[model samples]
Every structure is written in C-alpha cells, then in structure tokens.
Target: MRLKILLIAISLAAAVPASAQTSRFSPALLDRPDVKRALQSVDERATAIVDEWIHLVEIPAPSKKEQARAAYIRAEMQKLGLTDIRVDDMSNVSGVRKGSGGGPAVVFAAHMDTVFPEGTPIKVSREGDILRAPGVGDDTSNLMAVLEMFRALNRANIQTNGDLIFLASVQEELGLLGAKHWLETSGYKPDMFIAVDVGADDVWYGALRITQFKFFYTSPGAHTMESRGGPSPAKAVARGINALYNIPLPPIADGLGSFKLPVVNVGMLGGGTVFNAVPREAWFTVDLRSLDTPTQDRLTAAVTAAARNAANEEGVGFRVETQMGIDYTKAQPKQQRLDHPLVQTALAVANHFRKPGTPLIAPADVGSTDANIAVSMGIPAVAIGAVRERLPHRLEENADASSIVPGIKALISLAVALTTR
Candidate 1:
C-alpha cells in the first residue's frame, strides 16, 4: 500500500504543469544588451573589488564604533556618483540612485561592523587565493560586493523602474540594533530589503529570533579561607551555565512553519580574580534563539529563573539584563512565505549561477541579521552572502579570492531582477 501511495504521488508530481516551476532566468531581462555589458563590467572589475575588500576590512569597524569605516564607505559611495548620500545618527551610511520611479524601492545593505574589539590589528595578509584577516570574510567581502554592484549599475547605465538604495548599516554585530533603529525611525521604508551578508551558497528569507541576556551575580569579596559560608558569584554563574546548557533542544530542521522548541547556548562566561581572593562580581552572556515567540520567551524565562535560583541558594544577588535581542511580539507579518516573489527571484539568481545539477538555494534558515528588523516589520527582505569563507568571527578568518566574481555577479543579477519586477 505504501509503495502504491508513493507511486501515485510521483505520478501527480510528474503531471504538474511546467509553468509551476519558477524560471531561473528572465528572458526579457537577460536578452538586453546593456545587461550583458553590465555583467561583463562586473567581471572585469572583480579584481579591483577584492582590493577594496582588503582595504575596508583593515579599517576596524567594531560594533558601536564604526565611524571611521562608515566614513570610508560613505566616501566610496560618493566616488560612485551616487546621489542623496548620508549617514544616520547610528552611523548607518546610505545613498540613492534614482530609477524610473515606477517600481519598488530596493535596498541593498551590508553590515559595516565586526565582532572583533576596537584596536584589534586588522592588517590583511594574502596567500594565493585566500585573504586572511579579522573581519575580512564575515562581511567586508559582502560590503565590497555592494560597492561593485553600484559601480556596475552606474557604468552600465541600466535604468530600473524603482530607486536602488545602497546601505552600509552599523551595529549589526551588536544584535541588529542599527537595523532595528533605522527601520523604526527612518522616514523611508524600502519596498524590498536585501541584506548582503555571509556567502553565495544560499539566500535566507526568514530571520531568526534571538535574545541575549547578561547574567550578573554579585557577592561580598574575601580571601578563600574567609569566603566559606558566603555566597560565591562565580559558583552561582557556573550553576546557571550548567542548567541553561542542559535545557533540551528541539530537532534542528529547515522547515517553513512555526517553531516549537529552541536551541539555548551560553556564549560568554567569566567571573573571578586571583585564586586566593573571591571576586565580588561575575557575569556571563546567554544566546537564546527560536522561531516561535512563545518558545523563545519560555526558554528565556526558564534560564533567567535558573540563574535567580542559583543566586538565592548561594546567598548572592542575581540579575539578568537584556543585552541585545528582538522582541518577537513586535514583529509584523512574522513569517514570510517561502514563495514570495522576492524570495523566488533570489532563488532564480541562485539557480542561474548554481552549478548544474546542484540543489537550488537552501530552505530559509533562522538567523539573527539586519534583515530581521525589516522582516519583522512585514517588509519583503532577504539576506545573501557574497564570498566563500572558512572561519568567521575568528582571528584566522579568510575568504577565497575566487568567490568574488560570482558573488558580485549574483548581487547585480538579483538587484536588476527585483528592480525590473
């Protein structure tokens, strides 16, 4: 019976109309001679783009301190002959290239901040096709891709029906703060937002819901011998970490539906001085993630409660501060459908460049990105990566020089496709 059912399903699938399959390329758009020239220009300029990537990555744009790098990118945008250029109070740099004024306003954004701290020597070293440096691959590659796309559009003089807004957002690594603030306060809300991040392997439609908490445990300090019977903040923090990690995680799947469970992790933990002395304070950070708002809240509450309980048992003061996160309750049109036009167009671009017989773009995975703010606000948003990288957020971070051409090509294609849609 099972075999019979499977055979019937296969027959039904085979009988589906060809029109149901999304086209990987738009004939009219691809046939344009100007588009061909534009793409070629991107290919020709790919080497220069990588050079810009190295230069920008070495500028050091840590979380809240992105002024210098932001200024650099703003100047670069000016060099592209883009109009209406400006940087916001939060340090998000943006500019506009006016189109025919008939289509949607498309925003192409790349985060300008890195996870590294300020003053971390960002000197980049090249070894063959690999460029190694802090903040090199994680986002600098994508930022350069944005710049190259702008240059191609201007060079090709490819006019679209809508405005193409180029954006370099700040504080993205600090938990989407820049994006969230810009979306909420900026007078202009884009009809479509594309966050250029990560690599060329896949496009992400849904943004992950994330909650970060800094757990602080306070107690009286004393020498180890005299610290007996007094609550130890370090012990309380350790207990909280153990309990939080022990929280059962749901099976990880790339499904388009509501989430029932979450994956919890303790990212940073530290709290103690010398061995002989008991530290008066200690704190650790927790990263809680899920697609379901209720689940995220429940898990966050559980973790916070655990920390409090530990503190109480140890006779120490405990507190949990929301360091960075998305308020699930505030998001609008929460889940974007898998078949949204923007998403399909992105897949089309992916399929256009994807190796033959390789799978199309992967299913939308949960991630915390700048697009999260746009997606939460019911705006059609997607995030894509521009280069290949081995290690991200590490001192040894590196990107493949070979990935630059296709990466920028994909961005240019997707932007043109969406703008003309």
Candidate 2:
C-alpha cells in the first residue's frame, strides 16, 4: 500500500514517460488477459443475475420500507465477498471492496425502494428485448448491474488504489431520504459519488442541479354567495404560474449568477370544503431547478417573490412552504467545476467505448435525482447510463439487452481509470 501511494504521488506530481493512462483510464483493451477471461466467464452468468434481480424486484419495497429488499441485498453482497456490509439507519445497504493504496473512496449507489406501494405486482417477464415492470429500469436493473460489475471485477482480480463502495439506498422516490441519511451516517466520505438510478446508456456530465419551490395563495374562505373577498391562493398560484410561464428559460444556464431564468410548475393545489365556499386557505407546489447556484438562488427568490406579491395584492394570506428535510438541501454544499480528474477519466472511457467525438450531453433536466444530492453535498459527481436506451421510467422502460455489454465495459473502464491513478 505504501509503495502504491508513493507511486501515485510521483505520477501525479510529474508526467508519465508519455506512457499508459493510469490503470483507471487505460484504453478499452483489458490490461490483464485474466481480467478479460473473467469478464468472459460472466457471459454465462448474465441470465442468472438478471433472474435474481427480477426475483428481488418482485419483493415489494415502497419508499421507506426497504428492509426486505435491503436484507436480500446484504446477503447477496456477503455472497459476493464484500466486507463490512450492512443496512444503515435509513435502510441503505452498503458493502465495500477495499483497495491497496491511500487513494480516494468512490461510491456507486442505487435506491432499493420503488415508487410503487407494497403489494404492487412486480413480476418480471421478457417483453422481447425489454424488461417490463414498475421499477425494473428506474432502479432494479442498475442494482443488478452493480452486482454484475462487482462480480466481474472480482473474477478478474482487478485491484484498485481507491476503495469502492456499493450502496442500495432507500426512499429515492420519497425525496432521497435514504441518501440523505447515508451521507449523514457513513463513516467514509467518497471522492467520487455515482448515482446509478437513471435510464438510457447516456449521461449528464459535469452538471450539478438543485430544486427549490413556491407557494400559491387563495383568499380567506367565505360563502361564495356572500363572502367572496380576498385573492384566492389558487388564483395567486395561477398568477405566479403565469409569471413563470412568461419568463423564458434559457437553453443553457448562465454560469455565474445567483439566479437563472425561472422554469416553474404548479404541481398541486387544494384547500376547500365545498363548491359554495371560497377556500380560506389554498396551497400549491411550485418546482424550480437550475444548474448553477446563482441561477437556482435567483429563481427561488423569484418564485417566493411572486407568491408573496400575488397574495398581498389579492388580500389573501400568501405563504410559501419550501421542501424541508434532507432532499431539499445538502448537509453541505459542493463545489462547481468540470475538471475533476475522475470526471475527465469517465469522459475518456465514454468516448473510447462510444462513437468517436460524440460530445458528452450536459443537458439539464427539470426532474430531481439522487445525483443532485451527491453534487450539492460536496461530492464531485456525474450521472450516466450504463445500459443506454430510450423510454426509461415510462411504462415501457427497458435497457437494450445487447448494450448491456458495452455499458459494462464503459463502467469497468471508468472505474479502472479513476481508481488506478
């Protein structure tokens, strides 16, 4: 270990003799013949692993209720020879593959729980090349992929300088509660955090995202026939929504501001007893997201300001409630930069295996993801697809069965590159 660290230090401090990329970023050709053989061996086991994942998926694990699934994952990890594996307080299951040097820790996490409630039929069946099920692509496939990746690494005895941590998180559908808890509780802090709960084999590279909210207002309630008085929360919410609608969002975020052009949505609204009574209180949800802190902050302020203004002008109590608890904000803030070596290394792997010169897609998504937490909470993170595809998270969500191999190759290559140096 000491020797490995010294070597890494020397390498980092000076250029290599124009030679090999660090073990992490080595070209697509497997460095060790034995590693290639191991990967080949995994070929026969793919169906079995897929079967196991399907079996695990059938065991219903709604948000916050992942004990059974987590327990299953723990047993699987133990079977795979990982050490220090356990389910954490937030029901996140973790196991570590410790390495040989004084290098960074890397985390790859997938949520165990799905949005479906308990008793949802999670039966798996092959619909041609696609795997059709509620949580199959949203996460089950990734969880299974983690096992396959680790198994392949172990088979090849591919060693690393950095430690690898695998996590089966909980309640991602419920706002990343499991991630929030694990980040708070994990004794080890990772230099790289990878959230593997996305669909498609592509990625959003070097982008960090945040979610903020707005409140809608309605006038105090009175008989519709008589007490129609103040501005209604619903109307206030509508006005804010309109204001948001009028404000055009940029195709790309302005990089250095406290606010971005607001992209807003009024998702929900309710506060009334009868058709005849004007609602005394009306509350609605507004979601705003941005790629940079300044823009995100600016948008949040606009949403709040809009809600307040709308309420005051309408003579109704206009109050906005922000999403509270862990998912909304990080326990700590992460830095913004695109030059992390790991990010670069992953890009190298992507470019190597994927079609040449295809630029990494940094398209910002409005949806909130667990990756948002990793970035917001100080982990240099990138979210990507292992098995790329379309129709993810829809009723037809699936990974291209053939693409799984390339995806595996990409993941393995990226890991090798980052962990070696």
For each predicted model, how many residue pairs clash, with residues at least 3 apart or on different chains? 3, 23
Query: Once model 1 is optimally superposed onto the true structure by TM-score, how far is the C-alpha of residue 402 displaced, in angstroms?
Result: 1.7
- Please, what is the TM-score per model? 0.90, 0.80
Instruction: Write model 2 residue lDDT over 312-406, tens digit each, in one string.
Output: 76677766567732333432323232445655565556656664454543323322556667666667776655655445445555555555565
What does candidate 1 score on TM?
0.90
Q: Which segments of candidate 1 are over 4 A away from where they belong?
A: 1-28, 254-261, 330-336, 355-359
State, as a TM-score between 0 and 1, how close model 2 is to the true structure.
0.80
Q: Name the weakest run of 10 consecutive residues (lDDT summed) in model 1.
A: 16-25
lDDT by residue (40-91, candidate 1, tens digit) is 9977876787887888998888999999989998998889888889888999
For model 1, what is the C-alpha lDDT against the true structure?
Answer: 0.79
